[model samples]
Target: MSSTASTATSPLGSGAPPGTERRWLTLAVLSVSLLLVGLDTTVLNVALPTLVSELGASTSQLQWIVDSYLLMSGSLVLFCGALADRLGRKWVFMAGLALFTAASVAAAYAGSVTALVVARGAMGVGEALIMPATLAIIGHVFPQGAERTKAIGIWSAAVGVGTVIGPMVGGWLLSGFWWGSVFLINLPIGLAGLAAAAFLVPNSRAREARRLDWSGAMLSVAAVASVLWAVIEGPDRGWTSSAVLLSFAAGALLLGAFVTWQRRSAAPMLPLRIFRHRALAVGDVLILAGAFALIGTLFVVVQYLQFVLDYSAGQTGLRLGPAALALLVAGPLAGVLLPRVGLRTVAAAGLALLLASAAVLGTTSPGDGYGRVLTAMVLLGAGAGFVITSTSDAIVGSLPDRDLGVGSATNTASIQLGAATGVAVSGSLLSDHYRSALAADPHSSDLPPDLLSSAQESLGTALAVARHLPGEAGPTFADAARGAFVDGLGPAMTTGVGVTALGIVAALVFAPSRTASAPRDKDAS
Candidate 1:
């Protein structure tokens, strides 16, 4: 039960000798898996319009396309992570990759919205398996502390690369091909990974006596999925509807039960005891908040670029180039800086930058130039980069030496949760405010009755139709829709500012300044 950080500084490896060509080959396989997952998260966004046009997906179906993936991926990751620990990392990861690849093919060929939704959900299940399995393997393979940090830094950089490149790749595919091409893109990547992994990666078996928390896992999934569903459906169902209220009630009750059950269960899916450490708790909270703000806004921004600014898919991809470049530069710098500045200082700087970036974004209106957009995007990338890299280090460092699987599970789950919640929260705000704004506008009369009904739908869906309107009515409709979209962005930014500000205060009040060295005597188990 030695402190993970202290022992982690030394070689605590579970695999082959460091610097072997085989080791890097193993990393390459895992990196591809990571790239696919990250790419899939934002990739389909540029293709959403194409999806709607080709498949005739309604507003609710469009939301489902996105939300289904997040819900399953986010909610099931902890269970999947633990399952890998009890099983084997490489096998589970390979399985996840295979399943994900197959699902992509299915999604690509899906004729109906329902089939795509189901395929995407299946893809999420695969992603849940891959993410934690990869992290756990990193813990196993890179024994030496500095090498592990470097390895994970590369992993982190890919995450940034994935975030940046997803849009570009999706856009490129969509411009020449179709919406389904985005899903098809993953097939080659997955096949290459499978080929590499079979030769390069060493398998690690789960220790015996690790208990499965089936009931807790079910409840956790039910709770998170229900909550997300409620938020996504609130517009269609009416915010005050009986079903929405019931979903909320059920989610809250189940989550509460899950927490209570964790306190009593001998084996918990998520160990609440981990949060007793200040560094781990604060780091996790900031990671969650940062993930939400970054992901949620990205969803909205692509719509803004395409529907409001009239950028083509390829053009939209190019517009976002600055954010990716900023992250590529910032990620390595974070790896070098985090250990020196210490977690608290590094995290605070990140949160402050995030607050400033989000605040600036709150001011973005129609006709705002690319220069202003790039300025805010850079800050957002840097801030999110710090939180993700340093905080992941901190979370992993907090675990005991033997429970790297559990540690990875915790970290992975937190991120997914943050991502899901970010989409849910901001998406809810975006749709609600957009609808309200359009409904209240005096210019509503100018739009055809059917078109006006469409405008009151989800912000992204509304924006798409406005951009595609018939005749001279198109320009005015686009203008009104862009105003509502901006109207939504301001509130979303305000929410981000408030959330990040709270994170800053939380770090000051709670995060520890001690070296990341894990304490041996304090290991609870």
Candidate 2:
């Protein structure tokens, strides 16, 4: 169970260890893949307003544009991971990269909201294939211990780099080109990654062949899709609507079935017994919470800066620089500290920072300048960096050698599901609040019925309508819309505060005090 024993027994250990340079080069290539995945996560955020104007997308439709990719990627990753274990990691990864590149072109040229959403979902399929393989490869290339931890830290930082770069790049593209330009940017990056992967990346898989769990895969995909559908549609459909209620019911039942199937299956996609490791279980939960808060806040804040504060997309992306910078510094630092300190201490501190970030952001108002928001963004980024890096290490470190593929998939799935849910839940709260506030505003009384209906759809729609209104009425209506958006931002961020607080509690109660010296058995229970 020690690092020495793990390395000696590993399937990859049969040959001479890869040279230091080759290992690092392989990591760089894999990092590029992660960078692309991370970039897509937020690139669309700054483009949401543009999509509304160009495609006539409603609030729910915009959420779908974002969540569609996440839902598919999150749901299918487990299957892809198992397939990688059965087939070959390198082949699956290359195939995924090609598919993702093709999907990017489709997304870029999409003419309708539905087309874009579907294209994004296709991209997610490729993403599901790429993500787990990246991490699982790292597990094979680097032995367990400090080396592996450092590799993962750097690999994880690529995602942070991508997260920050996405908006800046997208904003710059939007300044001169059409909204589709954002998706187009991925074409060259994907191609370059494919080339690098072909030559530089090494192929590895589980030594033992396992049967694929088709039923479990189906149940998970349906459950997650149903839940996301309900959450995204609830605001517009009314929470009590039969469709929303039925979707939620179906999701719950499917989830229960999935658990039962996993428990009984001969070769399970995810071994339920792995959760017996306190560190692994708690780490997964914290990662989910961290992503939920981080992605959810970004979803709303980008809109707030552009709509309420009247910043251009480029300017808004620039303002987000502080968070990115903070994350860049915090991620590697967390990795260094994990061995010296302990998981509970590091994770709790990170969650506390997140809690503070959410509290500060929750107090933001339209009149407030960027200073308060800047402070919160920095905290959010740093908190996320520490939490994600440390927790990712914990998850990868706790798993036995054979579970690396599925375990890595589990980690990635938590992130995708968290991000998807964050967008759905936070967007829903924002829409509900925005609609309520706009309806109550005195400006609503003056608008004609048709115009009022359009305005109530979203802040972007309202502002578009205001542009055509006569003189002062135009300015007044726009101001009212901005105010409503700010009102919605408060509740969305407050929910983040609550989630982070719970994460803090969970970390303190369940996370291991120190990193284990050896990996736990997969069948620990």
Candidate 3:
């Protein structure tokens, strides 16, 4: 889609344009759609163990059930954002909601692990379209600065609210029903959202009338798909497997070609020019770093609750509430706090808090106190809330007005890609350490490989097992697993610390001066 297209106009120009009532209604409906998408993405996490038992899923398959959704959702943002602009934001957004509802119904009734994973992937595609388009609509609807800021706040709040409730809802459902109920829940909400959205949102289109960047979009999809495929499969197959090598090579080649083509094309899908603003660049990088740590933490923490604490899915969800409350407070507090201190100062403080929180998390032993874990959770949530809100504001504020949707894409894509990378890196680290530690132990001979894999996958879980195994063997395994996970956590947290430190430095040295206007064109990047 060309930059020439207008972002807002009636699909039928003569119709009454949307008013404040309609705008808020549209936001409400879109927010629900967002809530469903966000909830679906994370809710399945608490139900994974149950799903595995019921469906006879393998380690790789379980990973796919989570990862395929994330991978597709992350990869499709570039094209989807352009599609919203070219086709009509309202049209694309509603279509996504409809698709999502249908897919969720299919996911609920899935008979096998393969079917469930495929359904989740389809749901992810729906999610990719809905999110950026909704954001773009927010930008279009709330033209005034104060109103827009408030709108963004509401949008960000929806994320926190959705995240907090997702596990709790999934937990409650999984307790009485099957794991399928988590996906099943999306059906009614999606339908209501679809109905509400049709009446509320105004139609919008890109100003620049030009061809869609078909080549760029396809290349981008292939590039990201190939890379994600290799990264995901690498631990299962040996890293040097011929298929893995080919996937990696293809991903790199396609990605490089996409970048090259975008630079040369008259109407690029993902114009390289967006990277020019130092504030935007630094913000994008910092957003990725924060997401990396946060996601990696989530993956490990759930394991701790289920495996180490011996908590049921419902119990695990309930335990996460304090952290969620902390997150709820932090976004508003950070907005109040950020401008008072510079962005660099506030972000650095948050990252420092995160590093400290991770260290505290490493203190969990075979049967550690719950209070200590809860405190760590609060600190992590507070820090993450600050990081997410602050970085998001900086990225969007720094972008030129001409590319609002594209800017939104850059922000969302950075988040999705960052999350994808974090999961791969953190999961790989924990998996490798967990397996090696257990196999090296003298008593691991009787343990099945899958049992060992599950134990190796999380410290909390291993700790839980250690509490129950015959003849003190379980405790011994748990102790080994806890040690291995801590070892992995330290390095991952260290990487976060180092990256955040660099972001702080970059923000101070390279960010645009306060007096400067948002940059566009070649100078914009």
Candidate 4:
């Protein structure tokens, strides 16, 4: 295609090009869809204890309930990105919205734990389709420049808003309704997104859409699923167990094969050549690190508030509100500064702040008041706002229009992978530490072995069993369990701090000092 043809505003089936007014309207619809996706990520964290109480779900089951959705979304996101480029972005997005809406209903009405898990997996597929398309569509509507950067910042903020709102909404719902109400809330939003998307969004695709590479897609999904399975199951099953070892080995082989196939394929789904760009590679890594810290912190801390500090879901959500407010305030400001200070400085500062927040949270004691923790959460939100917005701008700005779907998908996939790993790793460490703490507690020596075993299984179980025991012994046991749980947070959050600290170095070393310049669609090369 000629550079002029590439740059020119093309007619959308209607003979006229989209106007500026229409472009922003389209963004509004896309943002709504993004908000729903963000809400789903953390909504379930607040519902875990309820799930355990209501459904008799084990600790491993609870982790799966969270990880299953992430695993599917992360695995299929890139493939869906390629599919969007081949098909039309709007078509895939609408289909995904429909599927997600339906899955939400199924999840809300699920009869058993297994049923809920299946419903969550289906939701993941829908998210994979919706997540990448939103950003790719934004990239299409906004031409590369300050306008695009600002637009991306808004888009990034929409996602941040979703994550922050998830806990609040979930907590409020749980206070008055059943745990299933959290999933049900998505229905009305998804229906509205579908209607708005149909009229406002334009259909767009790559200039030379490549043939779908089925082999590469399958290999990628298998590799991601197997690896996530290993991570999710490793702590419970024992890392040295044959099942875990085999899963790791298989994931490695499949991933290697997927890479090799992409290298040799005539029409590749993922153009590996893109990684050569420092912005794309580094931006993706930073996103991964940010998500790891973000989700893992949510997973551990929600339990801390509920099980240890004895806060209700609503109280916990309200306590977290300041962090959301901080993120909302900082998100757009980061965009305004991008042109002046560049991505590296903004992103590095964000990572540093996140590392500091993690360290503060790590020192939290079971009896501590909410003040120090709330301060740490504010820092956490600020850091997330800067990193998420700046890195997103860098990733999207650096890509050509034709590679927008691929690039957007990769960024979204990195987030899902990090979320999955964060939950798995942090959950594993906490579980191990909690069990060890329970076994070592002097107060537990007189308790029956089976009772101690039940207590060691999970905080929810420990608390539940403590309620059945009579007298001072019950209170003492409960106190020890809460202490163990709080102690576990130290190592898990410390792990997050270590990961984010590395992201700080990466942003400084690999992210460019200036924003990447996108070639105008109307300009000739």
Per-candidate clashes, comma-separated: 2, 0, 16, 2
Please write out the lDDT profile of model 2 over residues 1-525, one tens digit for every residue. 233443464454533233223678899998988888899988989999899899999999999999999998999998888888777778889888899889999999999999999999999999999988888778767777888899989877888668766777778878888999999988999999999999988777776746899898999999999999999999899999999999999999999999999999999888887787677789889888888888888888888888878788888888888888888998899999999887887888888887788788778887897898799889988998888888888888887756777888888898889889888998999999999999999988889989988988889999999999998999999999998988888888888888888999998988898867444222100
**What tens-digit string does per-residue lDDT give for candidate 4 at 202-246?**
777776667888888789889988887787777678889999999
Query: Lowest-lDDT window of 10 residues in candidate 3?
Result: 516-525
TM-score of each: 0.91, 0.95, 0.86, 0.95
The local distance difference test score of model 1 is 0.75
Compute the lDDT of residue 477 as modeled in candidate 3: 67
Name the lDDT of candidate 4.
Answer: 0.85
Per residue, candidate 1 scores C-alpha lDDT tens digits across 6-82 of: 34443433223222335666887788788888888888878776765678665556667887787788788888877
List of clashing residue pairs for candidate 2: none
Residue 502 in candidate 1, Cα distance off native in Å: 1.7
lDDT tens readout by residue for model 3, 1-525: 222222243231322223333577778887778778767767887887676567866445666777777777777877788778777778889988888889888999999988988898898788778877887777666543445555665666566556656777788888898888998888889888877877778777556523678898789778987887787677668689999999999999999999999999998988788787666677677767766666656666666677556689998888877767877787677666655675676566666666666667655555565676788778777777777666666666665545666667776777677767766766665555565666676666677776766655445445545667788787666666655655555554555555555655665666543312353321111
Q: Is candidate 1 or candidate 4 better by lDDT?
A: 4
Candidate 2, RMSD to the unseen true structure: 3.5
Question: Candidate 4: lDDT of 13?
Answer: 30
Lowest-scoring 10 consecutive residues by lDDT in candidate 4?
11-20
